[model samples]
Target: MSNKIKKKKMKKRWKISALVLVIIAIIGVVGYVGLQNFLKWKAPELSGEPKVGEWYRITPEGTKSANGKDWHSLIKVGKENKVIVYFFGGGLAVDEYTAARPLNDDGGFYADYADVDFGVKFGIASNNKENPFKDWTILAIPYSTGDLHAGSGEYEYTDLNGNKQILYHNGYINYTSFMKEAMKYIPNPDTLLIAGFSAGGFGTSLLADDIITQYFPQVNNVTVAVDSSLLLTDTWHDVAENMWQTPKEISDRLVSDNITLDSLTSLSKKYGNKIKILFGSSLRDEALSTYQSYFRNGILSTTNENGDIYEKDLAKMVADLQENIPNVGIYIWNEIEKNKDGKNLTPHTILPSPNFYGKKYSEDKSIADWIVNAVNGNINSYGLDLLDK
Candidate 1:
């Protein structure tokens, strides 16, 4: 071969080799991150005790977030024995069974907290013109571990790329540690309302009864209000039960509650009138429709999953649950006022929402009045506030 030809071939060979190396490196990084993206967490067992009538951030001893930092909750002082616990909602970022995420793929958002001055920024925490629980003490728990902030899990799963990873799913761990210490501050609450929206709402359904039971002796009335988080389906429930370690976390000991990770329908049925449970959701909430998609996971093509169908199904689910479960009331809303997207946020999160006060749901009651009923454990007195689709 000629010298010129040989030289040209050698140069081309080196270039091809470099490109191959670059491709390999990119794949290597993706694989490494995929292996690390397991949706799990463990909260350290909290030691010592909570202070009474004092505000402090309770960091669980051994609990670590997906970002590898300790997670904590902020407590604010309020009236003696009357408190409102609101679980802050953020989207769940992890789906173990190869389901595509609607937004970001990282579970790190589960523990993400913005240290805003809740007393001023949050209307629910402060005395607003229409808030009923303005004077009540507030306990805000931020969602950190992606397991709907509901699982107490230590699990392993094989990702889509065939990489095995371990997940902590330590929401139960975080709650147990926080609640145990919370008792010190809330020794005897005459009325306690546990409320949350979105993923936090789902978490409340799983965890609220635990609080009622823990303070059963002293609490005269305990109510739970779950907002825009009616994400229950048989398809994803089986996966969540196994992969998220959900069984024990959902088993409510407060009442003779027959716990099942299968569907909320039966769970609510068995929970008839045990404690007042109130639910609220928008007819066409975009945010929740995406989360609700998680319930069908692999059954429907993730991309083709019908949002309208899911939204109607969700509304129907809430309506049926209310009829089946006594003391279980619901406030269903629609786009009856000036809303941003018209269809989506007709009313996503009610308690923390600016529309929580006015915006009539019925002729005699506003959203604020319905909430008061929820906190007071009133049931079957309100009808659906559905707007035309």
Candidate 2:
């Protein structure tokens, strides 16, 4: 063939190849987006009896997230009759300003909805041998409603953009609704653990009494563990009563800004030594300090000064709990991580993090080991001296 004819054919072939490459790229992008949506919204049906050691997502009817999306929970059928009801943690929205912006909106205050696969791979929810609750049947409750899993009201507030919005703070309704369905699979338990982290930790303190008295009353060996939950606001009682519309029993317990302390103290008084109560926290949790700064100064900050203030508040909290609830088991750790500014800050929560099994309170005991001991009724406090550092 002549040189001109050959060059013309080569150019045509190159054009066709480029077009095919663009088409292929478009298909790949479309497929990836579709898969993500599927993962986010898909709810697995609990058709037959749940198989042993398998995780299943259960979406109960009439349950909704803070953003009005359908809410679902997770369960893992276990080898033993013992059970762990774990509440997952997200941030909170105390008022109109915080409510307008959710975690997805870069508000940094609260998560508007729960993801199906939130905490399945770490801490107590994991299948790792190091997890003491690994084989225990787990009913994992995901948090989204900003009410710490204890609200039953719809709150209307004006957003930062001056748009009126209604937040469905339906945490209480979601938990009860899903627990009713979860009971069908793991009906009766000889030993039970009700636990949570961060906002869910506060939920553990607030809802443990009602949950035990209502659902698993017959389980004698009951334990409640609250991890890394602290929020100091003088208006908590009013917020609980009017904004969240929590049950009167829960609302009544919120006489002070320290809801975790109030709830746990009251629960201790009611249950006596019948149930194990455990609490865990890092010395200077960065995320919690940020929230505390917002609550105290009306500015969200994670400065070392804010962290010191959180530590001071934590010391007071620990002292108050020890004074009021003598039997409560405390685990305080000083696990440091660098913040965005490269300053040292203790992490927010440990129970749902890899550090649950990796970090140790004593040279001999991992946090996992301490938890296992508490579950077996050997209640003791660890790392109390860390408060001074």
Quality of model 1 by C-alpha lDDT: 0.54
**TM-scores vs. true structure, each candidate:** 0.69, 0.88
Candidate 2 lDDT, 260-349, residue by residue in tens: 999999999999999998888889887788778767756666678878888899899999999998778888888677846776778677
**lDDT for position 386 in model 1:** 54
Location of the lowest summed lDDT over 10 successive residues in candidate 2: 11-20
TM-score leader: 2
Model 1: residues >4 Å from true position, as ranges? 1-55, 97-120, 155-166, 247-274, 294-307, 336-347, 380-389
What is candidate 1's lDDT per residue for 166-279, written digit by digit as tens? Answer: 556666677777767666766566787777766667777777656666654466576777777755543345445665666554632212211212224444555555567777
Give me the runs in candidate 2 sitting further than 4 Å from their true place.
Answer: 1-43
Summing lDDT over every window of 10 consecutive residues in candidate 1, give the lowest-scoring window: 11-20
Cα-lDDT of candidate 2: 0.80
